[model samples]
Target: MEILHHDVRAHNVMLGINCIVQLTNFETARPQSGGKSWPLKDKDEILRWTAPEKDSSETRYTSECDVFSFGVLLWEIVSQTRPFDKIKNGREVFKKKILIGERPNINMHMKDGHQISVASDNYFKIMTEAWSQEANHRPSMSSICERLRNIFHTNINEDEIEYTENPSKENDITALDPLTQTTTSENILTSNENNVKSKEEILLEKARQYHDAKDYSNAWSIYNNLLESDKGNAEVKFMVGSYLVHGPPYCQNNDIDKAENYLREAADDGYAKAQYLYYQLLFNKAGKYLKLAANQNYTEALYDHGYHLYKGTFERRDPAKGAESLIAAHYQLHNNALGKLNELEKRYAKEKKLKKE
Candidate 1:
């Protein structure tokens, strides 16, 4: 009857002999009366559990959010695999499809002497109701607990438990015991291992090889594949954006609009490099790309920005701005390059004096 954790993972849940469900992962949990919002930034993970109406700005989350999340957990427990695994970029896109009333498929089987069906329309109805987009329409935590208690009392049987599989293999479905139709641990483990891959490692290796050979086209292709695999992968997104911004040959010939799009995507994903690049590209259109680069905190970006500003390629000739940029460049220069920025600063000062005279 008591809550243990808000970040409940599969390993944290335990069923007791008295049919009591003990939960864990309550690091962020607060009293019901406390007006604290869950500090989650990525809505994608919670989308499947969220009600269709609650997807808006006006609706604030309560324990009902946990209800939605629990429905997904139940689905995972019954199905033996993560929901929407077959659907690429599932987390990012699940909310849109769920709002349209798309439901997870369920099937019926026999265990022991009892008939069990995890895919009952009633289950989906309850889940959808719990996840209703409107917070007011969704059931409260106490109500959800009551409903679950009733289901467990009626459906659970200690004797004659059996396991069976769903006819359709769309999801990893399995029956738990000979009498009870639920997913088995062995089947779930097998299905998970068979499906998921180390996408980051795969993409990183491809990029390394391509970059080493200076084959930017192939590098870009690998990065694009990774992006399609996991849109939330900020590192890959940044690499792809960097290639588009500074890549040679094919990428160079690509339209500025396309390059900007990729850079913007990376920037939005929180890649600092992408943010600097995006800022530069925006200013580049107005011949101010160089100055923006110098303003970046990174030394390399500062040097490049200073170089562009001093050259007056993007903006009107301004000796003062050029001198300031060069001074910044001088501070960032390492080893033998120190003289380069200093020399540029000296040259700009002389030019400014001559212009004034």
Candidate 2:
């Protein structure tokens, strides 16, 4: 479904917890068929932010209209002031002015009155391109995001960034964040609380890319950093622990004890996957961990926990009830578990026949 917000403007975007900007005011939002378009709507939006084509006639406005609105919104972001603030009757003036292709002037201070240093010329050029009269000429949202990323994070290598059109065939860098729009008040990431969140995102993405590229040593090195200390993310903990358990070639020669401990740490932090995987790996040896995962009804653990209950394998036995639960969970992906299920069915039938005879 192609969901249109209908309203795209500076005020519609607000900073939420963790310095993340979220879009609001979805009162006029509606879903369009994948390839179909929506007619012009939401005329009450800031007149300066409306696309020229949208204003010129009662033409069908598509996602491209939001692109035009975003171009004007970028002015609000850069100038940090309402467009045409100098003129009286600015509201009515901008509506007519935009129809003839007028747009806000890009400036220094952001809408919040905070001054920002220009990092790249492409930034302003991108802003101008978004306001291109022809909607087809405007850069796609993906392209806009990449330009914003390069500006936001200065060290971003052009080679590492993914492109929407005409992607390079050789050594393509798989994008970690796709279709996720993030906007800030220019210098917001530098603020104290948001800095930590920003660092976590950067480090997490770093580890993810290294892992995807099979740069195991570097991936593990980063994972190790995220694994240690109180600042470790639960996902990081689960990842290291799961990696240790499964030993994907990078983490081959699995460390049973370390995996259990790492996964246990995340389980303590209330991570469900960590609970289940840890339970599966250590249930026989560590019943407590099994119960921890079992409590969450983790799929594989449910089957294993029920199987153990049936056979009295490190748990209280109730063969009839447990077998029913075991078959109900029906974990077929794991070869060993599949074999056990088949064996249990055969044994159960044999015993039943013998009892009848």
Per-model TM values vs. the true structure: 0.34, 0.41
Alpha-carbon runs more than 4 Å astray in model 2: 34-45, 88-91, 94-96, 107-120, 155-357
Q: Who wins the lDDT comparison?
A: 2
Q: Kindly give the stretch of ten consecutive residues in candidate 1 with the minimal lDDT sum.
A: 158-167
* Candidate 1: segments with Cα more than 4 A from true spot: 1-20, 41-43, 88-91, 107-125, 156-357
Query: Which lDDT tens digits does candidate 2 get at residues 1-357?
Result: 567666788878999996778999876667754433344354544555766776545476677778877877787777787666665554465566666666666645345866554664567778888878789999987678766754554534445543334334245333323432132322233343433444446666878987898877556656766665325588888888877876766664678788888899889999999999878877567666665676676767767776777677787767775665566566534345545667877887898899999
Estimate candidate 1's alpha-carbon lDDT, on a 0 to 1 scale: 0.60
State the lDDT of candidate 1 residue by residue for 1-357, as single tens digits: 334134443445788876557876555566666555566454465455555555675765456666666666667666766556676664555655667766565442234647545534455556667656555677776566556644443344434233343245446333524543434655566666655445455456757777788866656656766777677777776777677666575354445676688778878877898899889888766455444555675566555555656666666665456555556656666342356567777888798799999
Deviation from native of the Cα of residue 264 in model 2, angstroms: 32
Give model 2 RMSD, 1 decimal.
18.9
Error of 1 at 53 (Å): 3.9
